[model samples]
Target: MAKLVERRPLKAWERLNILAFLKGMRTTLRWLLKRPITLEYPEARPYIPDNYRGTPTLVKDIYGREKCVACQLCEHICPAKAIRITPGPAPEGFSHIGRAPAIFQIDRSRCIHCGLCEEVCPEEAIVLQKEYSFSGTDRNAMMIDKEELYEAGGTLPDKYFKWGKSE
Candidate 1:
């Protein structure tokens, strides 16, 4: 029977070179010389882009009606299932069974902040606010319901996109 030999571990000098600290120190020095990329983020707000997509806000018409047609197109378009909608009653005094969302909620915790919902809305019922700071103390506080979303939603001005027209 032949005896098997175990190989010894390589010495530190013989080991492959990896710059873990040197590169980090270099980056730190560069950053120290340059202006900070961020300030007191939570306290100090920063400027936002015109097409910035932060949180989903629900829109309503001047006629006191929700802009959402309850088409479920936004729900279908969302990559993250952050939006929750339940069917609601039709327009009052009208026999036609039109659709409305009984419960329209957006879970900020699960949202990716993608603008797909805004893009897919036929009636332009949903939009992302210029406001980016979404910090909250409670878990439920982050979950914006219909009323809260509506309140957060600023005026529906004409949207201007650099790439294309704001639909």
Candidate 2:
């Protein structure tokens, strides 16, 4: 057998929702007095995860030779038209197989960070790096050239794991 339960009727003041509004205001005020979680930039750098794709960089072969064949695949595949490469034959005494780029430039302003250029690179020359803190006074300064790319890419300890590859 079940016991009979008595139900209490809501008062007019309770039905007005004043109590609910006061509870919400109390929660908001409590949060307002808390410290901010934001860090001071320039003095502090944010943590970057391993899979972060910040900047597109060029990589070198194990022998310190430029891995790019100057094939222009990355340039053609870039949807933003940010990549530009001037192809030229390798020097007479060079052991490299493919033509080298006379002028390779990446306009950071136009790059969309889609990683399409890195995906299409047959030689695996281009890779998305973990560097995001970048600033320039002028547009031309943001346009990264071959030398800068080489410097940034060469120092990387590991090559970017190709996307869609089985571990």
Q: Clashing pairs in model 2?
A: none
Task: Point to the candidate with the largest lDDT.
Answer: 2
Q: Which ten residues in a row have the lowest lDDT in candidate 1?
A: 158-167
What's the C-alpha lDDT at position 126 in model 1? 88
Residue lDDT tens for model 2, 97-129: 557777899999888789998889877788888
Cα TM-score per model? 0.64, 0.70
Clashes of each: 0, 0
Tens-digit lDDT track for model 1 on 1-167? 99999999977855744465677889899999998788796687788887889888987654455666577888878899888888787667534337777888888987898999998887777888777767778878778888888888744744422233333
The global Cα lDDT (0 to 1) of model 2 is 0.81
Please give the CA lDDT of all the candidate structures. 0.76, 0.81
Reference-based lDDT, residue 111, model 1: 85
- Pairs with steric clashes in candidate 1: none
